[model samples]
Target chain A: MFEHTENINNEEYIPETYIPTAVSHGTKELWQVFWILLGITVVDFIIYFAMGASMTRNIIFILMGLVKAFFIVGTFMHLKFERQFMILMIVLPALAFIGMLVFGLLHEGNALSIDY
Target chain B: MSTHTTVTNTTPTWAGGRSPFNVSYGKLMMWIFLLSDAFTFSSLLVGYGAIRFSYSGHPVTPWPDPALVFNHFPGFHGVHLPLLFVSLMTLILIISSVTMVLAVEAGHRKDNKSVLKYMLITIIFGSMFLGCQAWEWSQFIGEGARLNENLFGFTTEAAAKAGNLKLFDHVHWDMAADRTPGPVPFASLFFIVTGFHGFHVFSGIVILVVVYINALFGTYERRGHYEMIEKVGLYWHFVDLVWVFVFTFYYLI
Candidate 1:
C-alpha cells in the first residue's frame, strides 16, 4: 500500500523493476524484446507469401507459429513466470482439443457415412 | 471476494523494489476467470466446426465469401482485402495491451495522471475493436446473406468445392424461410458466442472508464494504492489472448 505517499510528499517515485519474462530479473533490454517481436512478425509474413506446396508451407508455418506463440505467451503475457502447475492447467486442455480437431479434420472425410 | 488493496510486504524495501511481475491476487483471479471464458468460446467454435462439418451436404447452402464480402474501405476499389479489418483489430488489441502495461507502470509510481491517460487509451481501443465487429456483423447478416441458403440448395458440399467465396455466401434453411429457427442452431451459436465475448470486451471498457475516472479524482491517492489498474490490465490481456485463438480457429481456419 502507498499509505505513506502523503508523508513522503510524492517526491520519490519508486522505480519498479518490471518483469515481463520468466528469466532472472536484472536490467531490462526493452529494445531487444521489441526487435525480436518485430522480427518474428516479419518472418511470419514472409512465410505466408513464400512460394511452396500447401503441405510444406503449412508445416513450416505451424512450427514457426508455435515458436512465435511461445514467445508471446512466455514474454509478452508473462505466463512463463508462472508455476509449472499453472502452465499445465493452461496448456493441457488446448492440447487435447487440438488433437481432436486434427483427427476429425483428417479422418472424417473418409470415415463419415454417406447414407443421408 | 477480491480486495482492491495492493499487497504490502514486510520483507523491507531492499527486495527488488516491489516485484511488478509478482502479480497481485486480483490480477490472478481475473486470469482464472478469463481461462474459463476461453474454454467456453473454444467449445462453441470447435462445436461449430464439428456440427457445420459437412457444409457441402444436407440442406445445402452456399456460404458467403468472407474476403469478397468486406472488400471495400470507403476509398479502395478491388483491394483483395481479406482479413484486413480483423488484422487491424489484432494490432489495436496489441496496442491496448501496451497501454495497459503503461497504466500498470503509472500505478506503481502512484502517478494518477498517467494512469488515467493510459486507461483512457485502452478504453478507446476496446470500443474501436467492438465497433469494427459491429460493422462486420452488419455486412454479414444484412441483405440476404444466409447461413444455409445457396444457389445449389442442399448441394453445399459441392458448392464448397467452388471455393471459400461461394461457401460463405450460401446457406440452407431447414423448414421454411418464414418459420422461426428451432432453438438457435449452429450459425446462431457462432454469432452468439463470439458476440458474447465481444460484449465482455465492451463491459470491460465501461469498467475501465470507471476506474480511470476514480484515478482522475485522486481516489486511490487517498486510500493507499491502485490495484484496480492491475486487475483491469489482466482482463485486457486476457481479451487479447482470447482473440488470438478466435482469429486462428474462426477466421484463419
Candidate 2:
C-alpha cells in the first residue's frame, strides 16, 4: 500500500543513501505473508498426495504454485513499487509461457493412457 | 565552431543516470538476461515432462519411481534419503543471495573490506552447493540406473542382465539383487544437463572469487562504483530461479 516508484534509478555515484540497518515490517503484516506462503506450500503437498485424478491434481498444484509464485515475485522480489509498465515487462512474458504450457498440457494427455 | 566548443565542454555524454527503461542499466539488463534463461530452463524441464509422459508405458520396464530413484544422502549408508539434498542446495543459494545483497550494500558504502568479505562468503556457498550437486550426480550414475522398457512403461533403472525383460516383471525391490547394472542413457542425459547447470554455479563462484580479489586490490574503489556486484547478483539469482523449475519437475512432479 505504501509503494513508491521514484527510487528506481540508474545513479552512477556509489553513495550509501538511505541504507536502513534494520529495516523491517510490522509483525502482523510480515507474519501474514509468511503464513500465506506456508499455507500454500502445505496445500501443494496435499494436492500432490491427495490421491485424486492426476490431471485434476496437476491443475490444482499448478494454480497453487502460480499463486505462490506471484506472491513471491511481487512481494519478495519487490516489484510492487515498480511502475505498471515495469510490472508488465517482468510478468507478461512469464504469463505467456504459462499459457503455452496449459495448451501443451491439453494436447499432452494424448501421450498418456486414460485408464479408468 | 564556437557551439562545438560549448557542446563538448557543457553537454553531458551520460544522462547523469537516466534511462527510458526506468530501471538501472545493470538491473534492466539482468532482468532481460534472466528472462531468456528462464525460457531455456523451462523448455528443458517441460521437454522432459513431455517425453516422460510420451513413453509412459512400454514393454520391459521397471518404471522409474522418482521417490525410489532420487534417494540422496543426509548421512552415511543413506536410508532412502528424500529430496533433502535439493532443499539444502536451495538454502545455500538463498543464503548466497543474501550475502550478495550485503556485498552490493557494502559496495555502495565504499566499504571495500566488507564487500570482499561478503563476496567471498557467497563464492564459498556457491561452491558448496555445486559440491552437493556433484555428489548427487555420482549417486545417480553409480549402481547403474538405466533407461528400461517393459510391458507398460519405459523408465530409468538397471536393465535385465541376460534375458528379454517385460513390463511388471518381478525383481527384488532392493538394490542388492540383480546387480548387472549399466549406464542408463536417460540418466546420462539428466546428469549432463543438470551437471552443466551445476557447472555454471561453479563458474559463477570462481568469478565471484576473482571479483573479491579485485575488490581487495582497490579496483572497484578506484573505478568508483560497484556495478559489478549487481551484475553478478543477477547471475546468481537466475541460477536460483532455474532450480525452482527443476525442483517441481524433477523432484515433486
Candidate number with greatest lDDT: 2
lDDT of each: 0.57, 0.59
| Residues B1-253, model 2: lDDT tens digits | 2222221223232344333334555566677877777777666666666656644543343335454456556453545544556656766765676576667666767778888888988888888888888787667656554334112122234343213332233333345543423224346547655865786787788778878888888998897777677567667756655665566666666
List TM-score per model, in order: 0.65, 0.68
Mark the 10 consecutive residues where model 2 chain B has the least summed lDDT: B1-10
TM-score of the candidate numbered 1? 0.65
Q: Mind giving the per-residue lDDT tens digits that candidate 2 earns over A1-116? A: 12223323322333233211223232344335446755765565545445533666666656665665565455444456455767888778976995587568668657554233
- Candidate 2 chain A: minimum summed lDDT over ten consecutive residues — where? A15-24
What lDDT does model 1 reach? 0.57
Model 2 clash tally, residue pairs: 18
